[model samples]
Target chain A: QQPVQSPQAVILREGEDAVINCSSSKALYSVHWYRQKHGEAPVFLMILLKGGEQKGHEKISASFNEKKQQSSLYLTASQLSYSGTYFCGTGFKAAGNKLTFGGGTRVLVKP
Target chain B: EAGVAQSPRYKIIEKRQSVAFWCNPISGHATLYWYQQILGQGPKLLIQFQNNGVVDDSQLPKDRFSAERLKGVDSTLKIQPAKLEDSAVYLCASSLVFQGLNEKLFFGSGTQLSVL
Candidate 1:
């Protein structure tokens, strides 16, 4: 089952901030965040495992809530280079390395 | 380290035609996966392999779509009698392991297919 993403698309000016949410009906053990620019492969941004372990990469950050089965990605001080599609892939409880992805959220950071 | 490699950066074919895409995963990687990403959507897993043995194909359209990883190295996905709906970017990814919670996927620049 695919997760659901909120704020399907967002447009931001440079130096703006945005939050993308990924929620799944089933509980997830971990959540992986990736960004895919046009015509390119999806690149891993970060992975948030259960128990509220946080990982940050430059201006990108993410958090996972084990109890709620949700993950959120934070993009602070967005730049034009941030324009791309953000996807959240969830590792379900019963599955092993079988991640089901959510409908992506498109972000456009303009000057 | 080199990431997954996919052949045919782009393809254009008419409906009812057949096409195949190849993938070479990162060296020493044990798991490889093929995904179909429709426009404006996240990729959907078509098949997954662990060291030349199929681990998953529940989502794959077995009738016209098939994949194989021979010698636990390179892989190929073939679609016979392609349909318009099959026009999507096919992505290949690999991971070091097929189990556990800390695994990460490395992807290749996908093949963009336009079935006319």
Candidate 2:
């Protein structure tokens, strides 16, 4: 099943901070984040593993709570380049290597 | 590295018509995925391939959709007798390996399909 994302849309000014949350009903082994600009492909952002291992862009960070089956993406000091749709893909042990994505959260960071 | 490549940036067809999209993954990547993204929605996984073999296709509509990754380098997704609801963007992505779904994926620009 697809995960759920909170705050479907958010608007922020430069230098502001925002948080996007993703939750899945099924136990997740890992969570992957990506950003997609209009008319472009989704770009890989970060991945948070169940054991707390995180890897991705140096400037971007995210946290995964294994017990809750939730993950959150933190956008601090937002930049104009951060404006895009954010998606969280969840991986379940039973599903093997398939990653199921969430509905997505749209973020607009203005100058 | 060269990113994943997709053909036919845009396609339009009438209901019941057939349409096909093609994708070429990164040179050394061993895993490929196809996803469908509707307006205002996230990309939904349609199928997954691990070196020319299907790993998952539970979300694919077998009644009208079929896909193949020949030679483990390139793939094609075909929708026959397409329905209006099939209008969306088809995205192709690839990862270096099938490492427990933890590897990052590189995506292609995607093909936009419109069914009238």
Candidate 3:
């Protein structure tokens, strides 16, 4: 099943912070985060596996809560380059390598 | 290393027509995936191929869409008798392995299809 993403869209100014949430109805083995600019391919940001793992890149961080079947992405000191659509792909252990993605959250960062 | 390559960046066809998109994955990648992204949405996996065999295609609309990754390097997705709803961007992605742990997917620019 497709996961649900919150805050369908967000507008932020430079140096602001924002959080995007992804929740799945089924148990997730891992949650992968990606960012896609307009007319471009999705770029991998980070992956949070089960066992309450947390991962970060620069000012962007993500946390996965296995018990809650949800993942949250944190973007701090947002920049104009951060403007794009954020997607979270959820994987289930029983589903092997198949991953389902959420609806995505569009972020627009302005000066 | 070269990224995934997809052909015909944009395509426009009338409803009931057939269209096909091609993709070449990064060298040595064993897994290839085809996804559909409608406007204002995330990429939805349509099918996945492990080597030359299909590992998952549960979400593919078999009646209208079919894909094959012959020889495990190049893949093609075809949509026949397309409907207006089929108008979306078809994206091709590849990964070194299919494992969920620490796996990152490399994607192509995707082919935007507009069914009129």
Candidate 4:
């Protein structure tokens, strides 16, 4: 099943901070995040694995709560380049790494 | 490393027509995925392949959609008798391995399909 994302849309000024949350009903083994601009492909952002292993862009950070089956992406001091749609893909062990994505959170960062 | 490649950046067809899109994954990548993204939603996984073999295709609309990755290199997704609701972006992504879901994926620009 697809995960759920909070805040369908958010507008922020440069240097602002925001948080996007993704929650899944089933237990997840990992969570992947991606950012996509208009007319472009979704770029890999970060991946949060069970047992606290995280990897991705150096500037971006995220947290995964294994017990809750939730993950959150933190955009701190947001840059104009951060303007895009963010998606979280949840991977379930039962599905053997198959990822189901959330509805996406749109972020608009203004100068 | 080169990124995943997809063909026909944009395609338009009438309802009930047929359309096909192609994808070339990065060199040596064994895992390939096809996703469908509606305008305001996230990309949904339609199928997944590991070295030319299907790993998952539970979400694919088998009645009208089909895909194949020949020789573990390139793949093609075909839609026969398309429906108006099939208008969306078809994204192709690849990962270096299929061991775990934590692997990062590189995506192609995607083929935008507009079914009238």
Best by DockQ: 4
lDDT of 2 at A34: 96
User: How closely does chain A match the true chain A in each prediction, as TM-score?
Assistant: 0.95, 0.94, 0.96, 0.94
Superposed on the true interface residues, model 4 gives a C-alpha RMSD in angstroms of: 1.0
Encode model 3's per-residue lDDT on A39-101: one tens digit a residue: 999999998888855899889999988778899999999999999999999988777767888
- TM-score quality measure for candidate 1: 0.97
Clashing pairs in 3: none
Look at candidate 2 and tell me the lDDT of residue B25: 95
Clashes in predicted model 2: 0
Per-residue C-alpha lDDT of model 2 across residues A55-111, encoded as one tens digit per residue: 546556798888888998988888999999999999888877688889999999999
Per-candidate local distance difference test: 0.91, 0.92, 0.92, 0.92
Q: Is candidate 1 or candidate 2 better by DockQ?
A: 2
Chain A TM-score of model 1 versus the true structure?
A: 0.95
Model 4, B1-116: lDDT tens per residue?
68999999999999999999999999999999999999999998899999999999989999999999999999999999999999999999999999388788999999999999
lDDT of 1 by residue, A1-111 (tens): 789998899999999999999998888888889999988999988887887578898998888877777898999999899999999998866875688888899999999
- The reply for model 3, stretches above 4 Å from the true place, is none
Candidate 2 regions with alpha-carbon error over 4 angstroms:
A53-58
Question: Which tens-of-lDDT digit does each residue in B1-116 have in candidate 1?
Answer: 78899999999999999999999999999999999999988999999999999988999999999999999999999999899999999999998877455688999998999999
